[model samples]
Target: MIQIPSKIQKIIGNEKYIIDNVGMSGSSVYVFEDKVLKIQAAGSESENEYLMMKWLQGKLLIPEVLAYEKDDSKSYLLMSRISGAMACDDYYMKAPELLTDLLAKAIHMLWEVDISDCPSIINLDKKLEMARYNVEHDLVDMENVQPDTFGGDGFKNPKELLEWLIENRPEEDLVLSHGDLCLPNIFFMGKDVSGFIDLGKICIADRYQDIALCYRSLSNNFKGIYGRAACEGLDTDKFFEKLDVKPDWKKIRYYILLDELF
Candidate 1:
C-alpha cells in the first residue's frame, strides 16, 4: 500500500458508477470511464492481492494495476476495466452449457499458472491457520452460511466446524487456485474468457478449493438462490464432465464446509 493521491476520495459517492457487486469483502468499488477502483481497509489479504496481480501480469487475463495507494486506514486499487460481462450475467446463466465450459476453462487457466515462484500460498494448512483465528475471534459470518450448517442439523457451532475441518482434512492436489472462484468473480467476452477480478484470495491452494466454490456458485445461480432464480438450475454433473475429472463429492463437501470458517 503506497501513499496515493486524494483523487479517489472525491469519487467515493459520486454517481458516475458505483459497483454494487462488492460482495462480502467489506469493500466499496467505484467505476470511472476506463478504470475501476476498489477501496478496502488495510490488511494482508488486500496487500497480497496487489502482489498477485503484479505477478500475474502476463500469466492470465487479469486486470492491469494502474495504481495502488494507501492512506492511514484504507487501501485503494485502481485498475483498467476488464472488458466483458460477469459469468453470472443472465445471458450466460441461460446458456448453461456455454457457462459451464467457460468456467471449466477458467479453472484450467488458473491451474496452469506456474507456482515455482508464487508469492502467496494458502494451502489447506495455511487456510486453517486463519480459520482458527476467525473462529476464536467470532469473525466468521454465521448468517451467510447454508441451512443447517450450524446448530441442530449441522455442527454445534463455528468452533466445532473448524475442528471437524482440521480433523478430517483431506490430501491436497496443490495448484494455483482462485480461493473464491464463484461465477461473479469470472468474466467472459462472447464465448471466450476475458479476465478474472478479485485477487485477494488467489493462491496455490488445493485444487478442490476452487472446484467446490465453482460448484456452489453454479448451483446457487441456477436455483435462483442468489441473483436470479437458477437457470433451470443447470445440472452440476455437466460441469464435472467438462473437466473430465471424476466428482470428488467427499472432498468437495469438505472444502465447501471448510470455507464456512472464512
Candidate 2:
C-alpha cells in the first residue's frame, strides 16, 4: 500500500530507477542511481532498524544512511547503495563447495564484531519470547513447520517445542550476531564474500544462536558440508564443536521455525 513520495523523486533527481522489495520483511526499498531508499510503515521494528543502521555506520559493511524522515504515513531511511555482487544464492547453485567455507568465515567474522557499544538492540530473551508468542497466537504458518533433524521426532509438536525452547534457552554469551545469517543475506563476489545485508536484526546474543542457524542452513543446502570428514577438514567437531558453548537444541529448533515465519 506504500508508494514512493513525489518529493523523494525530486530529492534523488530525475533518473532511471528500479524498485525491488530486497528483503523478506514488509519494507519498501527503492534503488535510484547509486542510492538505496528504505522506508518502513511506522512501528517500533522500523525505528529499531533505523537505529541499528545509524549505530553500525562506518563500523561494518552496512550501507550509510543519508537521510531519515517521518511523516504521518511512514518512516524512511535513505542510504548510499552498496555495489559489488549478488547474494550467496548463485554460489549455492553452481559452486556448492564454496558455501561452507564462506559461511564459516562469515560467522567467524560476525562473532569477532563487538556490539558492546550498540544501543537500542533487543535482547535474546525478548526475541525468543516474541517467537513463542507468534506461535501461540497462530501468527506463524503451521504448514511450514518442518521437523528438526537434530531434535528427532519431538520437534513435531509446536507447543512442546516452544515450551522446551523457553525452558532451555542458552546462556547469553554477548557476541554480535548477524541475528539472521541466512545464505540469502550474505553477498559474495565469485568465491570471496563481499558483505552482509538485511541487518535490521543485528544484536548481541548467545554465539550458538547464530551458529546453530548457520549450521542448519549449511546442512540443508549442501549435504555433508560439515559431515564427519568435513569436520576434520575444518579442524573442529563441525559447527557444534566450534561453538564456545553448546546450544539448546530445542531453542535452535524453535528459532529456525520462527525464522521461516519472519
lDDT of 1 at 99: 94
For candidate 2, lDDT tens digit of each residue in 1-262? 2555666655776665687754656778787778888877777666766788888776677777777777886887777777655544543445444555566666777777777687855566787677777767877665444444225654655566566666765556677778777666776766676677767777776676677666665555443331222221222244454444464676666557546443
Q: Which candidate achieves the best TM-score against the true structure?
A: 1
lDDT of 1 by residue, 108-198 (tens): 9998899999989898888999999999999999888978688877999999999899899999899999899998899999999999999
Kindly give the stretch of ten consecutive residues in candidate 2 with the minimal lDDT sum.
Answer: 226-235
lDDT of each: 0.86, 0.64
Q: Cα lDDT of model 1 overall?
A: 0.86
